[model samples]
Target: MKVTSAIIAAMCLVSLNLGYGAFYVLWSIADQAAVARSEAGGGFDPSQLLPYGNVMWVLAQLLLLAILVLDVVAIVLAIATWAGRRNVGRAAPSMPTAAPGR
Candidate 1:
């Protein structure tokens, strides 16, 4: 038996939401740390205080963004696929296969 469409959609949404939340939390860490360090009256550079440099932080931020985008798209595609499979079973018809009949 297959899962209900609503369940599939919900699962996708949960996965997507959690992924985005994680990405956001990871992304904010650097900015927050930088702000904390800079509050020392600008007497020192935040990058110097950081265990990781600005470049590494920014790269990590971008990587998280990329993962967020990919996961969001995967969520959408998974929901679509589940719905399609439910609406039409194996009888739904597959893409044209290479054959002499074609």
Candidate 2:
């Protein structure tokens, strides 16, 4: 049904928004930390790069989680729609039919 489809689309959009928000916040925090670390050390050390890498790893995991959640929602919607249609079909057979000709 159109309603179910709309709901699924909305859920996907929300998940995307969450993912974007997570990435933006995490990246900003990591950037600030890396800058501070470099400043305190008076030079950029290779070890100082770990914060960025860790942030990237966390973002990747969160993105994957978002994707998994979206997929599960879509599948549940599809199954619900299919079951709805099946129930409607089963009920249709019991309904009275008008005579072919008046």
Candidate 3:
């Protein structure tokens, strides 16, 4: 139970980091696009931001996917952990009590 909980926590942390990375990449891409537009001075040629822009976009998408997968795994593990605890509690044998006047 403890181990499962630990694993879930780790996955959540990793997911958070991935989320931050994805956000940063997306923000960078938008900033770059804005700069390109401003530099164009009237005609914004998106082609000017070709391969590099595509690569960054792909990277951001992958990071987002990773975050989604990690979060799903963490949620599954948490549910399993809860079920395991519930089963253990139900299966545990209670001690017998003494008579009231004993």
Candidate 4:
């Protein structure tokens, strides 16, 4: 792939990671707060009402795994692009130019 394309791809990957990370942090905080408030109430334990919080946490972990995989792929692609550029720069000319007159 062209160097320009690779740069663009890297930028996009970084943007996506930042967006997902921000949202994940916000959601995690909100979820934790809700759990705390529920536990503090005098009524029955809130966990019993939402036993699936653990499941949700597991799902969130899977989302994190996906983001990590994407980051690794992006880094590898960027490195490959740099390697390709270096190889191209170092390669010797394959053919000599012909004379203007025979």
Candidate 5:
């Protein structure tokens, strides 16, 4: 069924989003801690010399949160779509819509 394939695809997308979000959050916290430890242990402030790491860390944190939110949104969308929810996508409604230009 077309709807079934779309649902499966959506599920796969959600899995990847959540998995990557978890990895991102864990990595950001761990990396931040590691950087702090290394710095406190006498590692020079290379960030002052090369700002990429600092920028990357910040970006990673924001990205992690964004991904988490996006995953939640995707789950909500998937569930609503599967249940024949109305207005989920008026433009191109799911199976219940029949078709466009009708």
Candidate 6:
């Protein structure tokens, strides 16, 4: 249980970091677009952004996918932990035993 809890915590942290990374990547793409627009005299051209935006967009997508996978893993771990505890409870009983020569 402790191990599972630790793993879940770690996964949550990693997911958070990935989310931040995604946000940063998206922000970078926007910044680049804005720069391109300014360079083009306020007319935004999709072609002007080109490869940089494309690469950042791909990276953001990959980060989002990783975050999603981590979320699923954490959820599965939580459910498994809950189910394990439930099974342990069901496997143990506090019934009184018959005394010898009673």
Best lDDT among the predictions, by candidate number: 4
Instruction: Encode model 1's per-residue lDDT on 1-102: one tens digit a residue.
Output: 245875776687678668767766765785677767677674766553555556766876686677678767867887798788788745755797797876
Model 3, span 1-102: residue lDDT tens = 878878778876876886687677777877688667757777756555545766766777797787778778877987897788789857568899999998
All models: lDDT? 0.69, 0.74, 0.75, 0.77, 0.71, 0.75
Q: TM-scores of the models, in the given order?
A: 0.43, 0.44, 0.57, 0.68, 0.45, 0.56
Candidate 2: C-alpha RMSD to true structure equals 8.5
True-structure lDDT of candidate 6: 0.75
Off by over 4 Å in 2: 44-102
Q: Which stretches of candidate 4 lie over 4 Å from their true place?
A: 47-52, 92-102
lDDT of 2 by residue, 52-98 (tens): 67667687778768777876887798799778878984645577779
lDDT of 6 at 98: 100
Q: Clashes in candidate 2: how many?
A: 0
- Model 3: how far is 73 from its true place, Å? 0.4
The clash numbers for all candidates, in the given order, read 0, 0, 0, 0, 0, 0
Model 4 Cα shift for residue 74 (angstroms)? 1.4
Clashing pairs in 3: none
lDDT minimum window of 10 residues, candidate 6: 42-51
Q: Candidate 5 versus the native: TM-score?
A: 0.45
Error of 1 at 63 (Å): 1.6
In model 6, the runs with Cα more than 4 Å from the true position are 1-29, 32-36, 39-51, 92-102
Judged by TM-score relative to the true structure, which candidate is superior, 2 or 5? 5
The weakest ten consecutive residues by lDDT in model 3 span 44-53
Worst 10 residues of 2 by lDDT: 46-55
